[model samples]
Target: MGATGTMNDAWLTLREVRAGDRVAVLSPSWAAPAHYPQVHEQAMDRLRERLGLEPVEFPTTRRTTTPRERAADVNAAFADPSIRAILSTIGGDDQITMTPYLDARPVRADPKPFLGFSDNTNLLSWLAYHRVPAVHGGSTQISIGPGPAPHPLHLDSLRLALSGGDHVLEVPTQISEVGHRWDHPRALTDRPESYPAEPWSWAGPSRAVTGRLWGGCLEILSWVLAVGRFVRPVEEYQGGVLLLETSEELPSPHEVYRMLRLLGERGLLAAFDALVWGRPIVDDERMVPDPVVASRARAAYREQVLRAVAEYHEDMVVVQDVDCGHTLPQHLLPFGEQITVDGVNQRVTAHFRRAPRP
Candidate 1:
């Protein structure tokens, strides 16, 4: 379906974020990575300096164990009429713990752009349950990291998420191929060797298929599944564009396949019309042993996804490496916005029919 109603699938007509918007920042679930503090400060600076939006930070922005406290902050942010949006500094591990405490009534009454990736999947999936569409990418720390500013893809998606549009985001032609030790003493200046960008590949038809974009960090989703907190659960996701990426934790290929198999078991894999797999974030310190282990990871993922589709979904199309999550130059995805995937033509485009930029 292209689009049926203004508030129906994808909800194309609403502008979730605006210029001069006041956003409250909170630590939705897990604590930020070691470099997170610097990343957070700099990212907020960019939003104010470049985007001209005001960011409000809650006391739990750095707290992970305090799920209730974090949930309270979210409640405050959503209930505050002055704050137009709520942005997670970045994703954490156990945000699903906050779901029981969230007052979904106020959120549904006035939905705003809630952005984050990785562990923040908790909020995105939770909001989706309440019919509050969230923008699935862009975190104050990761998206606006200390690199050369918002990596182009990072900026493009964030702008689109905050502003909305019909546009193409360029993948990183040159990529940060390695990871840094954030908690280590010498993280500020230690940069990794750069890797050249390869064009994105596809495994589906060239014609475009529009659907409300869904899915998030794969591990996060697994956790959400473990906690039984999907929006409407597996069946509600039929005909959606499913996007997934792995974190720096570097779960093994076996672990990845196991998770996919579990989703397959849940009848989730067969539900989506299309699948977009992000380039797994490969980190050295994670002791993954293989710097370019992405190849193995890709092979394993393909096998699992294909198995799930073969068993459950035959017509399902797949797209790999569209560049979202854990990777540098992260792109913002509309959690419930309509997106058109042009796989066969060797291009993937996301179109938005939102209000004009502020």
Candidate 2:
């Protein structure tokens, strides 16, 4: 495996998947599949019926195991030639713990597309640090299983990630931050209620900026930065487009600002020419139950994010409230591939081709 920051020109090769290609579905973080077998099964069924791909599960896919054990499953998945791609059952809090146990040899030897977000950001960052490209969002448990069917926007992006192509992202008119309880029988048949989605907010210059994509769930990224193993030299991120989103955990806007402030202090903030902020889940409806409060919280998050960015580079291109991350109808981003953030035209284009080697 190449040293951190040394393999800037080479990115993981992403092969287009055929209809019957086998995809490893692993729970590298929490075993949500074990807890909600019904939901997991439905997600698997959709993976077959909707995507026409076979879902392969490892011994630990539905079981909560030690970090090393989880790493072993990830390693086995990557080393298996039959597995064309890897998908997470869901994201959890401790994926960062499993990172050190992952062996880079298989990942470097056979780089396949891995789709996940939230806590899965740990693995995504690990892959990026090792020069292995993957997708930023696609939780089988969240995106596929919970609702009546997969979100159209998510399905489109997942197809693009698996089949390989350039796609301009579509913004959904309605979005949902919370879904029905997994244990509820209605979760399988009913669609979660959604509200009118705010149009994506763009700031800075009107010109377009294009670069390779980086960043993920802000909380998980804080853990990644603290561990310092997955991060390359700050210069390695120069000109890359930063992708950021908060999870359903709904950290305060101050917390969001602090995380970005830390990135600025580390010189990581200024390295990116553009930043794409995923639509944030302001408050859990179950907890707050007030749309007005959720609306205000969302605004504060946007304010803090912009304040942090202004502190470092006020002219940096910033696009917020994108339909990615914790929000329902999420779009998967090509983690280590090129993306064009067109502020002038207000569009985001993702390039899905295998990155060239130097």
Q: Pick by TM-score: which candidate is best? A: 2
The TM-score values for the models, in the order shown, are 0.86, 0.96
Model 1, span 252-346: residue lDDT tens:
66787788778778887777788877876655454233535655555666666566666766676777666776766566777877776776665
Worst 10 residues of 1 by lDDT: 1-10
Residue 48 lDDT, candidate 2, scale 0-100: 97
- Checking candidate 1 for backbone clashes, the offending pairs are 205-344, 206-344, 206-345
Q: Candidate 1, which segments miss by more than 4 Å at Cα?
A: 1-16, 33-36, 63-65, 177-179, 183-192, 286-293, 353-358
**lDDT value for model 2:** 0.88
lDDT score, candidate 1, position 48: 89
lDDT of each: 0.69, 0.88
RMSD of each: 3.8, 2.4
Q: After superposition, how far is residue 314 of candidate 2 from its true place, in Å?
A: 1.3
Candidate 2 minimal-lDDT segment of 10 residues: 1-10
What is the C-alpha local distance difference test score of candidate 1? 0.69
- Name the candidate that leads on lDDT: 2
* lDDT at residue 187 of model 1 (Cα atoms): 37
Q: How good is model 2 by TM-score?
A: 0.96
